[model samples]
Target chain A: MRKFFVLLAGMVLFLASSLTFIYVKGENDSVNDLLSANVDALADNESSGGLDANYHRIDSKCEVFVSAGMQIDIFGIGIITAKADGKIAIDGKVVCQSKGNETCRPVECSDLYSVILHGGER
Target chain B: MRKFPYFSFVLSLVVISCVSQTKNEPNVQGISVDINKQADISEFVSSFDGYVCLETYEECLVNEIRKLKMVGDTIYVADDTKITMFSRRDGSYLGKIHKHGRGPGEYITLTDFDVFDSRLYVLSNVDREIIMYNASGDVLRIINTGEGFSNLSVIDEDNIWLYSSDSNDSMYNFILIGPDADVKAKYDKFSKNQSYTIEDITFCGSVSDTLYVSQYYDNIVYSLHYDGYVPLYRFDMNLRNTVSQEELSATPLSELHKTYKYKESFRSIMHIDRNRHTLFAETWCFLDGLALKTCFVKADMVTGKSHFYICGYDVDERFPLFDLSDVIGYDGKVLISYLTAFSAKKHGKKYKIGNLADISEYDNPVIVFHTLNY
Candidate 1:
């Protein structure tokens, strides 16, 4: 009876240790997955030039659904390209983002006009 | 006799009450339109009357039509720089207004013009002057409107309504000027910076004595009264993309383009016209994701039963895709639009459009006159 009691106590201790190890490992994996997802999202935002708010993308597969020569007029500003090249042109003059800027933002119409007409930033 | 008097008095009181109630009722009707609902263009457009292929020549070639108006058998087609007159009956070239210069009778830019009582009032926005010409193309007089008004509507010989989208004056967007070039009154005092440029051509349109004014960056259409204007109709498009007056005020003028671009917002209301108590507002909406959406919200001024029609997304492929971008004017009788000769020829073959059967791909744009059913 004394030998049986000792074995039972050892088994209980082993089961608790294994359960704690499994719970800790599962939590760590979940945390690592969340971190990886966040990193991937950040990388995508960076690689896309971060103008998701300004520029809209029309998928190439959906291009056939739209009319030919369909233009999105930005209220008389400049026409931002939905193509993958990400080129923005105003009245046939291509205006690029400022140098050394990782992210993109809207270029003012007047600023774009000045750049096109006077060949420099306003 | 005493009973008769009481009855008469009671009748007068009831009449007065009814009149007061009618006056107090809101003139502007709030129309709820679902932009997603696809409607057949044939439901609103009754029949195609005919097509006029504007006679094209080297000397009278219209590079682009900015505004087209018809008056007294003459169709006035104004391009960006010049105005040319063509015969309404046969599309023959009559003459061109080729007085673009800085001289006394000349204008630097022909922004807008109106034909009233055989006189042509041409507004030169850049020059800030209006040169009046008789029917024979003789210069009558030049009125120097102190401000650069981008558009003008001649109410009568005495009153003219002027609108400026490029004014630094934030107090008023419209100025009513008299014959003597004096400021008569001002309307539409928007709080935002009024200097931003918008490319809408028609601001205010008149049918009979009633003139409807479409406010810039606003959804309310107003009827111009003696002192001010009263709201005639409100277009409730239920669009997610809209900028409030506060947002417009808070946003810098330089950043306004960003506030409107690529979003599914009502960019600007163009071609506000009314015929037989039927109001039509050609609303231009930007690209929604991948689809290009343009809608025309037509409402009955009496019953307020509104119809929303989306171009290029009509129910049947047989109907011609009519976008408001090509709409020139909506007369009381017919809604006039034009299609490029290329498009007319192409769509003509596909849809079997009878009016476009005689169209040539190399010819000028075919002017299609549409009669509205609803």
Candidate 2:
């Protein structure tokens, strides 16, 4: 009985460690992918380097509003729509999140705008 | 089924380990502030003076005042398009600068401006240059800095500091440039790519020739030294008010905003100003998606005792100009901000203070000055 209990405990411990590793690794991988994808858009070519992927460079005259379902339209940069069910899409590509996903969360219209436009809440 | 107890125990252990990864360990150094608590208005300002209405004219039409600076008797108000000057005593209209072109000494867009020694230094990010002009708007010199920057401050005759928060997309966040537009020194390079957007031109300010700079997303405020930066103060935020820096860096950029945890968290360090041994830091946080809460932190550099307060929140007596929301310039001695005719009249009546009772809603904005204790 004692021997069987030890073996069972060992199996559980191994499984737990493996699960935790996968969880952390998955998060790091997603972050890495984001950084890598922006390389081309944020390259350091002086002539064309004014483009900033982290900010939605809207003209001061362009009116911005946070309406129902988090809809914001920047004339040149396509439309961004975020739904209360945890779905965010820029030009229908679903860049921020999917419905009921724990990954991305928005509490307000400006938060949605910040996520969609400024890349982060800060 | 009989072994269910053992299995459940193992599962609980796994959950605990995962939770421990994000456990909040209170920061031991610096001063920790509870930003949500109510505070007294007197803590921010020692005294409140009257108001002055800036004279408006066709040539000095301002859509909105983004920044206000004072040099001697002149009050410089900069909007998105141009910089207009007014008398400090009576708000009389002085000369104005409205040059917007691609030609010599012209700026495409007015991003930032500073007044030092009767000279106006305007930062043109789109043109990637600094246009130095006399108080009368005559171009003294133009220095083209090859790269664009968000803010610039004249440190002295030889050193000028240009700062930007877009580190991932830009070469450096802090660059010390010479009068000749040469890069004297560059600092704040990250090992990995990172970027955050901020809209304040007050991120960098000086008191007595010493320069202070703070990144919006960073917790530490640094003073520029000869070689690098020296960390002056660290704001240890309560766990309830902030997301850990590690968590912020780990989250993917696309999913960062969607993180509900970040919705009501500490947003950014908006402005930093120092007065003698006391340093004042104004911070912003999301109250909700639609609103924002401003927090003011006053820290004693010598004793390390800090006072944290929320502005425009519950207070016994509300002071309009004392709020950090409209804070334009603070030079250790005086704090200045602008109040629209509506607000000036409304607050002036409710509080029974200032000369704003007679101002009309159609009139120009009234500038209010406050005397500081710290």
Candidate 3:
């Protein structure tokens, strides 16, 4: 009887651990992507000698699906790339998250998607 | 075995809560704020200067929208090529004229322009010259920049802010003169600091003085708040532009979004008619996806909550300020114009004629909104 109860508690803990991993965040999640260009990719064909300016590029990528109501407020501007095998519709007007108010969180976004672009950066 | 039912219910609850965050609707968990644009524009316009003033310009004169200034009944619209004049009484199309130069139509590509009293201040590409035009559309003076300009905005009628786009991108404030423009003050006191690829600079909505600068290289927007050119908010908000494998393989849609990467930030910003309280914003940023993602959003500064309606599809002929303004006027009611019509590049090395015309795609290539009211 003592062995049976101990085994049951162990099983419960294992189930709880697995469930937590699936529910919350893990190692290679979507938000903390680190894939940005640090070196000046602009005017690389030409030497950086003539120029005296310095700037770095930063970007991140995550393939997981960001269900619907999620919103990311990029103050000035930003873009999100969606990755999937099927037709993925991203609402640009999404209410992911805003870094504005701490205690007060605003929620009124129903759409978020992607923007079409032409040509590479010059 | 006896707790099987309880375990099953708990598991379902956890899954449901996690899945609710990715949709257009709030989780029925957080606080919801109502800011419906379809809610009577008349009541909203009543508070701002009697009539709801709009920046109505000729479509042929502008492709990428810049700045719009309204003074009483006179509305001045600036494009990358020319300055358009309009009357606000009934949103009437007044007179249109190009900046004077070698000949009648001789003018450089205009990025920004400001009109004060009888004078129109213009900023051309390469910081070549600062043009001042009289009320009669005659060139009053053309002042060349020794250091050149990247962008230009109005501080007041006489003080014009000039931003450089050279190897070291920085901005300076200058005073407009009759023939020779002079430096009145150094707005930012920029001293050989390089690390920012300044694309375009504009002020925050309703803030009047706070300047928001976009650095595409850093994927950040620097908020330079007003302290008389001292900068208020230099907050860095992380921005990322991504394109998926599926988007790259899509049909004509894929061919579309890969083009607008010419400037630093490949995003276009437009203002929505602000009601008495909330401020509205819309963006047309489709430099990937092949499909255009049109973003329409509204925020209540007081309540700290916002609502967004994002819709995407092909470059429908009628999907922009042009579409919404179509109902605002008559034959020439809500006018749009392009100063220059030339394509830059598409995807690869080759450049195509860019869409410089402010096209009024009036419900042609259709799109279905995902959230809020369309």
Candidate 4:
């Protein structure tokens, strides 16, 4: 009788250990999958020229950094920061900058006029 | 098993909450004006008389006219580059206001201009400034209006009304600025949906002291008082067939054409005659889902009668009765100009009242005056 009781307790302990092991393994796999997904998202944000990560606008102060091609318009009496090589139109004039050419300046009127008057030609 | 049921119940509750969140929006009401019948242009316009011919002269030859305003005896004609002044009595070239440069007083692109109390206000899109000039084309003042202003109208010597296409959190559609470019007041009467590509569709004009404002989508015409805007009139445009803002937000922009297959809308109110209680507008809509048609509309505010007329000229017709242009109201009269050498030349003899024969290919447009028949 004593041997049977000891054997029964040992079986119960073994079953509990097996169930705990399965649950722990399943929990670890889920955690690992979540970590991997987060890492991929961070990688994407970095590869996209940090556009989504570093967009900010305060009053008239705006900073936009895009990796791919984009057409952006900045208005109001404010400073604007854009990525180099991006086409930025401020007050209808297109300004294309090179890499690391982030500068905040007010939009100045272009020297060229859109329509030429025939008064001089005539 | 217990956890499974609980999770399923929570998921179903979330779905139900989301489904119930989309409330049914009420349909906006507007005054519907029937535009199915065609009308005779002569019935609306009492007479199409020769007002003032802006003769294409050497000193004032305009390539493309952007805006026109008549202040007293001077006719202010603004092309894309310069604002050329001409005498309204004899079509004599006075002087040209072409400050085209990168200087402090120069402008890159002339978006719009207005004349009030003998002062000409030229709004530059690139410079974002209003170069105020006297009647003789002399620069009186240079008002720096920040940037992105699409149109402007000089209310008085001390004040001017400006319109911007872009709307920020604080500023809305219109802004009232002083002569020093200081923002006196900003009005936010309209909502920005960001659905349409063309944002500068708001038409603003003033009859004496009362300023009128209207948009392409909204049928209500608003009047600016001290600080608020009051609805003066509403046109029933039958916008039921138009696309709703909810649908616009749901559909991807790429698939917009598939969802809203047809686009029907009114153009900006070009001319509003207060004396005759009449307004003129243009309509652009898909015809039979095949081609786009441009139709002209005239509505009488007193009787609520509106007429839609097709713009064209028959070969045998002597005078082409209807041709829509950028119209402006002045002193109880509405003025519409036509390129006599190009479009109006095809319309036979009666339309050739102006100096059409002398007008060259690159000459300025000829002006036509019409009095509203009440």
Best model per DockQ: 3
Docking class of 2: incorrect
Model 3 DockQ, alpha carbons vs. true complex? 0.03
RMSD of each: 17.4, 21.9, 25.4, 21.0
On residues B1-374, what C-alpha lDDT tens digit does candidate 4 reach at each position? 86999999999998886665434222222345565565776645566666455667576778765566777777778776888888878777888888787776777767678877777788775566899888666789999887446667777888887776432222456788887888787775344322112323344556666687764434456776447666665555553355444654455322444333334443335444444566665444333221223445576666767776544311212234334232433445454554434433333233465545445545566665655454
Question: How does residue B314 of candidate 4 score in lDDT?
Answer: 16
- In each prediction, how many residue pairs overlap at the backbone (N, C-alpha, C within less than 3 A)? 0, 3, 75, 2
Tell me the spans in candidate 3 whose CA falls farther than 4 Å from its real position: A1-122, B1-70, B78-80, B89-93, B103-107, B166-201, B204-294, B300-304, B311-374
Model 2 bad stretches (over 4 Å)? A1-122, B1-29, B167-170, B190-196, B239-241, B247-262, B273-277, B288-290, B301-304, B315-320, B323-325
TM-scores of the models, in the given order?
0.67, 0.66, 0.41, 0.61
- Between which residue pairs do clashes occur in model 4? B31-B236, B32-B236
Off by over 4 Å in 1: A1-122, B1-27, B166-171, B190-194, B248-254, B273-278, B290-293, B300-305, B314-325, B352-362
Q: How close is candidate 1 to the true structure, as a TM-score?
A: 0.67
* Candidate 2: clashing pairs of residues: A104-B258, A105-B258, A105-B259
Better lDDT candidate (2, 3): 2
Docking class of 4: incorrect
Q: Rank the candidates by DockQ, best first.
A: 3, 1, 2, 4
